[model samples]
Target: MDKGIAKMAFLHLSPPSSSSSFLLNSSIDSIYPKRLFHLSSNQHNRDASLQLPSYSSNQGSRIPAQWRIGVSFFVPFLDRSSEIESLKQQLLDAIAPLDRGADATPEDQQLVDQIASKLEAKNKVKEPLKSNLLNGKWELLYTTSMSVIQSERPKILRPNGKIYQAINLDTLRAQNIETWPFFNQATANLVPLNQRRVAVKFDSFKIAGVIPIKARGSGRGQLEITYLDEELRISRGNQGNLFIVGMVDPFYRVPV
Candidate 1:
């Protein structure tokens, strides 16, 4: 799939609230469908009788006694599976920090679960994935050397002072899917949830951003990156370290 198409589908979440303002009017004839109106209690006065007018094929009037003529509006929320999924993932990310670590207690879990339930209800949740099924790791794609160190922290002033921002794609996927399931589900087939995996097929054709650079502890850094032209995925272990075994010929070079 085209990366642009996939990206758009992957992020479409909620419909605009203003869309509800559109009005629908239909004729009161057999050839034309009559628009149904929901009657509010305030609209009906003490001496008013709710009347509904209907027309036959011959344009004849048919009325029922004490008929209530009002509009009952129902918003059609359809084909939004992908958007919902995206929203679900966002929610997960927000709550992940609170629920992480060995110090987290049952109370934290309970709070997370309760908040999750509320988010699910708001988005009309569908299928839920097991949270702990897969191991999680951050992928070091492209990091800016000019790292933003907090003002309060001590600055390690050295010529080789490099800044690195480690990004966790797996965590991003999990967070977006968990929080905004509605949005993601709507666009799943367009982008595909499986595509979320950092597989070579997607990496070679998709990722957009800066080049991937590496900094070794020895103070020597290799800036081998193929940005814009294509994306690359580094094989990783549980600790987020790159796993390189066997012959290092074409694999050692920057991604094509």
Candidate 2:
């Protein structure tokens, strides 16, 4: 277990120093332990191929703005290789504190041994989650699945330097989205986000019926995509401008 702890220890100490770094430098403060138990929250009540509403930007009618999009792949959780390294660093860092006598007991060493034994034994039993590429349409930044942290929810940081609640793509469509579309009767069906687990296998995707969204007080607005699918490939252009951009493969991020 010291191996696992050691890896995590270093993972916490250092993090990638870029905007794109989402997982590598996860720290104890950000890391959430895995759990076998599942707790269902809100469920999807609608489909992903819903229609979108339209909104205009606050900028004077002449200037153009574009939407900022991001996507990341997701995989199952596992005892990270970094865990061992993290533990080692943690032990080294703790030496100084230990010298200050944080714990003075004969059982401390025994406790460490027990933790190590448990980590080693459990490491063999754990497996990583699995997912598939977005049919080569979307560029993948990075991906790693996490066990649902009981109190944790995904965070979406906006371009304005403000953070907002992150909604699973499916949930965003199901709850906030409203649209009309023609779905492939043979291929597509509205499935429960919780019930579906098959790896993504789409060869192409389309975004249609996009709604414009703006930071509440920023005096700027970009399109908020609403309905998207194989059919009715329509989306709002900047400032509710409508356009049809279709292709062989479309990049998209679907939250699992």
Candidate 3:
């Protein structure tokens, strides 16, 4: 395959606008039709009681002007474009071998270390952690984390196909699905270890729609977030794997 075409194939698997929820639900229906029906029936009663609030045009106007002004000064601002770009480049270099379905070289391992160092430095600066910031869809650009990467194991780290992650803040759960050339799915429970760390316990893993691989013990492992903002996230796994993720179609509730 041509390099450009191969790269594109590896990165995006599904249509740009396809919802992860739709895909997941479809899989659930196929795998456990009876269970899904039962869940839907149970949810109907709950849905009827939970009415959505009506939007009011005057809602914003009700906020006191003085209060709004006072809050503005407390907002945090960070511009790390230069640093982010540097990290992105390093990640690209580190995963180049994998992109071609080749094994990572010693040099690639070195680049991974460099990326980890940069993430650690960024994590040292305290930044507020908000679930809203984490809830949404994200594309897996590059990762050394084995939890996400499964056995079809490219000798080189070429992560071809589309890998997407959907996080539900309300439920404190995360779902990941990949498709096209590679097919895998996993669900995890997100536990906040601290401001900059999270313990992701993998609940299950499924390959090619086969039986789910139930996680043994507490979960798969954990991840230490080094950097998180509107557009990017960098994390390190307990097993020394590095993860670099970028937003898919990020829509922030507040300005970053």
Question: TM-scores, in order shown?
Answer: 0.19, 0.15, 0.54
As for TM-score, the candidate ahead, 1 or 3, is 3
Instruction: Judging by TM-score, tell me the better candidate of 1 and 2.
Output: 1
lDDT of 2 by residue, 1-256 (tens): 1112111110001112322111100011112112100111122112222232333555324334332221111111122423433432232232222211123133543443343333333332221111121121211111111110001222331111110111123322111111122110001112222321111111111222131222122111122222222211122222222211112222332333
Better of 2 and 3 by TM-score: 3
What 10-residue stretch in candidate 3 is worst by lDDT? 19-28
Which digits, one per residue and each the tens of the lDDT, describe model 3 over residues 76-105?
222344455455445444554453213445
Off by over 4 Å in 2: 1-168, 171-232, 237-240, 247-256
- Per-model CA lDDT versus the true structure: 0.21, 0.20, 0.47
Best first by TM-score, ranked: 3, 1, 2
lDDT string, candidate 1, 98-125, tens digits: 2121122456445544444443344321
Worst 10 residues of 2 by lDDT: 142-151
- Flag regions of model 1 displaced more than 4 Å: 1-104, 122-256
Backbone clashes for every candidate come to 43, 27, 10
RMSD of 3: 15.9
Q: After superposition on all CA atoms, how large is the RMSD of candidate 1? A: 22.0
